[model samples]
Target chain A: MPRGQPPLSLPALIYEPKVRGIIFQVLLLAALVVAAWSLASNVAVNLQRQNIASGFGFLDRTAGFEISQQLIDFKPTDNYGRAFVVGLLNTLLVAGLGIVFATILGFTVGVARLSSNWIVSRLALAFVEVVRNMPPLLTLFLVYFAAIKTLPGPRQSIELPLSSFLNVRGLYMPKPQWLDGSSTIVVAFIAGIIASMLLARWARQRQVATGQQVPIFWPSLGLVLGLPLLAFMIAGQPVAFEYPALKGFNFSGGMVVQPEFIALLFGLTVYTAAFIAEIVRAGISGVPKGQKEAAAALGLSAGQSMRLVVLPQAMRIVIPPLTNQFLNLTKNSSLAVAIGYPDLVSVFAGTVLNNTNQAIECILITMGVYLVLSIVTSIGMNMFNARMALVER
Target chain B: MDAGIRNRRIAITTAALLAVAAGPAMAQTKTLDTVKARGTLNCGVNTGLAGFSMPDDKGQWTGLDVDLCRAVAAAVFKDATKVKYVPLTAKERFTALQSGEVDMLSRNTTWTMSRDTSAGLSFVGVNYFDGQGFMVKKSLGLKSAKELDGATICVQTGTTTELNVTDFFRANKLNYKPVVFEKLDETVAAYNSGRCDAFTSDHSQLYSERLKSPKPDDNVVLPDVISKEPLGPAVRQGDSGWGNVVRWAHFAMVNAEELGVTSKTVDEMQASANPEIRRLLGKEGDFGKGMGLDNDWAYQIVKQVGNYGEAFDRNVGAGSRLNIARGQNALWTKGGLQYGMPIR
Candidate 1:
């Protein structure tokens, strides 16, 4: 109540919300810079005290370690940089395969769980309950130790139906050796594909214009299959089957899928599919019963209702979570280390880090790869989710 | 009012962060001080390498490397049991040592040029002299290492043995595939599953691993020692004073063996009239004090942990599961390469 000549105008300006927020932000930025600087200096001082050269210069050094299951042509004499590429490719390969297989298996199991049959739904329910309760790493251990270890030894490899042998070493199948004229067959098959696509377009237009159907499906199928056979006969059957024969203590002259790769793929797919199945079931159930009834009242068949009506809407609810499953499967591929699959973490971070003693660089690179992979997966998922989003009026 | 409190908080945090990093800039390093302050030495050993460092059912550690750790503990605290064991795999051993996760790494690590020069580590000295060799089934009808060309071999990953095997095959112009695993148990399982034709490791390790096979008698270890693997103890690259402590601790045991001292007789030898024996038992010289240890450091080490000869016999030599001969690990006087320096 004792009024001064100046009514505290400067304090009001200093204590403004906008100015306070700016000050807070600047202080935060300064704090972050200080923290980062101190951490970097700590690392530098430790490296100096230990006389360790810190940089990517060690990547040029000859990596004397051998990675067993490399996707690239990695040799013991290759540099450390090549080792990282090999590891990254292997990680991508397993993640890619795992996502494909898991989507198929998960959708199937989800449909089965939604079935009216008691036995089918119960079986699917049991599978999801058991697997969803267990850890992914434990599932990997079981697939590797219990399942893969029980396969027959190389000498007693089980004869599969398609010239493939199942054994403890791997699944060895016949390799197709292309003699001359194989390219002509492949070109003919591609021509058949183009012809089928054109026929589908023509049939659609004709049906729209004239009140008649062209019956294009059977003809397209015939062209796709028959053209390849016609080309093969014309080429005098240039493909020779080089079946895997037992030579010495192992199989020779064939394509072999190592047990480590199989175990990793199986474990990742099966474990991820359990959770994906639940997501899929929730999406399918989220479609109201009234929607299907409405389609039936419109004189649509059951299959037509599901394919043209229910699934499209259900997928709207399914896609965002499904994208999450895909990312989870990709990140979980790093668990291939447990089975010695030579994935990124195993080959690059585990072995290379130990051999070169460049832990910080190796770890940063590994984390960077995973971060980029995750971001790319999320971006792809976001694109799909946007496409499936509800349309605004 | 708010700015005053926030500024004070910021000052405290900055001070704390700077203080966290100010230790290394001091004139003298403090690895020994840290170990003493912690009261228990963190010793990294193999996860379960039988002769080197394996735990029994009672969780008591006993092996060559384990004994060395106890000797260091005895030398420091005069209490041999004052030690903590960190079980590390081949892939984790170097990092664990370099990061100071363990004060010393007494794992059976092979000393190599790359490991010493670039890996920020220093090999104390050779504790067990070993050589890389091959093991195969008797059913193969292969007699020599050279005859087993184009063979798939099982090897532990992140090891010098893998590089050695690759060099062996390349130098001989042979083709082969290597099946590598992270764990020794997994490597053995893959080999036993008929996934590989041969398993290769140090000769001492081959004997121990072969015993774990289903039919041990059906396998035969090849006689060729392809590479000289001087397996020894390693410490971090810095702290020369601590490195010297670990190195001389092992040397003291070897020297005691050369001086004909044992754990049972070390107390009696302390009353000897001989100058060399008196100096070694810390009666005449203050060498232990120069290393920042008590004058009776060697006495405690020998009295509690025994000499190097006893450790070798009970762990990997003739009295143990390995039953390896003292080819290069015997003392210098016994025509072996285990040369010891003068304790004085």
Candidate 2:
């Protein structure tokens, strides 16, 4: 390599591309640090000047407030930290159920939208257009008012099957009371699930090994269904149903599900399913036309061709967009504050933040929670996406 | 490479230190000066509560709480119409005041220990002496809150009413479930639709909410007062100058009522020979100078916004639809709790 005749001077070094890039990057980072520091200090000094309390110390203080829906055991005497956990669990419960229901409904509607039947496609198209056009909050308001308005009062509640009562207050059904031997039945149910999974893997391997296929559906179903029944019988029928009994003001001694929960869950699921349906339709259509033809030529029925050949490829496209819908539904669950569902944002952020008056701390913690939840969801979806991705070979 | 990294670290540390040192300096602006510069008082009121702080078709806010804001504005600007009413929810009131988004909060906020101390607010004085009560269907045949056992009660959250209901139920050894809401309208609607066995709130609010229902005559407010709710205006803490201005504005109104000075009679009362009336009407002393306001501050309030009795009558008393009787809210001489601090 050719060497320079003389060493570069200070001005030349500054003008050098490598040296200039490093200097500018350092300057940018320093500016960002200063900006962040000033913002934090401004909040701190403002809070201090106003004599408003700061910090997470208020988490241990007694909440002194009651929540309507609590997933875990909580009372007014419980501390703020427990209240937060209860609210988080409630949010997770709704979002988890919302995701499962929305996915199923979305996939069905998506397939219906592509169906040859004129009525089916038109109905699916109408549902997607109508629901997706309105705001989720408006939908929530509509659902909540409809539920409250149409249902009968407690005195004139509609009696459902299994001794359940449907009223404006809530839907009250019989709660299952676990006896001493209930744990044995639970263990048996879990074991049955594990056994069915193993049997399915064995059947798949047998099909791959030989041209002949062994029927695994009935055997797997029997194991999953029969084992739990046998355990229940052996345990002397350890669970009993506690029917709801009408008392002075309302029903007593039963599992009472609040209308707020129903409305919120229904609104979120219905609204999000509209978007998911579109995503699913796009995914199914993205598959090559040749794949279906190939499956059809192999003597596969239309359902078999779509399910076995088209859907597997469509999943890779569906998973990423589906992740976004899941995240949106989770965040939108905070609208529970409007309807009094006692989700995390409703109970913890709204009530706890007001009670403690630690706005910065409470808001930061709440934002952090959503951030972590979204990140975890993304990581899980990415892992599943990687598995469904095309093989390089 | 090490030298470059070391230089960058030094630069970042120095900048951070300087930035932090500037924070307290930036926080030292006086609220009074800011409000004066803005030429209008940013007063926080309820989003919409009948007879307390509701707006009409033209967006003119009118209520007992809205009058308090006008009184403060009249004292400061000598024009009662110079207030910018910021409607806030129960959950957003304190934060709005503490953040300086509103100069003062005239919302129907309860004067609690935590709010006055840690929430960075100072209560001027009680403008409304209310108590938590239950409103149920008239056909229920329930006489008292004690009969509300096994009842589902709907209540608004982020208020003293939430804690009060829990305490009341626990003290009475009764079983009840609370369905807490964020807004007053939602709570009222839920109760109206039979989603709750009873709706609990400040007695004044229950009356106000009852009027908004489909059939106001169908619901009856129970006589049981579960808790004391001294609703009043509040200003941010640490700004004694601004705090004194709002506090004296409220006091001037109460004092005017005690001295028999209504808005119609305020001009004649200014010419009275009574020394106490003269001092209150800005004829004898410069009382407003101590609070960084005009000498005619109290006069402006009395002349433009009327005295406390007039405001109460016009907003929530017999003159309005609510027609709430002055129970504990009457003047101290009439066996009530609203005694003004001596102007002297």
| lDDT for each residue of candidate 2 in B1-344, tens digit (9 for 90 to 100) | 12343244334333433433345653367788888899999999998999989997788999999999999889989999999998877877776676567889999999999998888898988899999999999999999999999899998878888888889988998878888788788888888988899999999999998898999999999999989899998987877888888888899999999999999999988789998899898888889887888788999999999999999999999999999988898999999899988888
> lDDT by residue for model 1 over B1-344, one digit each (tens)?
12343243234333423432454663244677888899999999988887889997799999999999999999998999999998777877776676566889998889998888877788989998889999998898887889876677888877888888888887897777777677788788777767778999999889888886899988889999999999898888867889888998899899899988899999899999988889888999899998899988888988999999998999888889778888899998988999877887
Worst 10 residues of 1 chain A by lDDT: A1-10
Model 2 regions more than 4 Å off: A1-23, B1-27
Best by TM-score: 2
> Where does model 1 exceed 4 Å of error?
A1-23, A179-181, A184-238, B1-28
Write model 1 residue lDDT over A53-105, tens digit each, in one string. Answer: 57899788887666767776988788989989999999999999999999999
Give the best candidate by lDDT: 2
For residue B183, give model 1's deviation from the true position in Å.
1.4
Best by DockQ: 2
**What's the TM for model 1?**
0.91
Error of 1 at A28 (Å): 3.4
Interface RMSD of 2: 10.2
Cα misplacement distance, residue A101 of candidate 2 (Å)? 0.6
Candidate 1 local lDDT, residue B197:
84
> TM-scores for all candidates?
0.91, 0.95
Kindly give the number of clashing pairs for every candidate: 0, 0
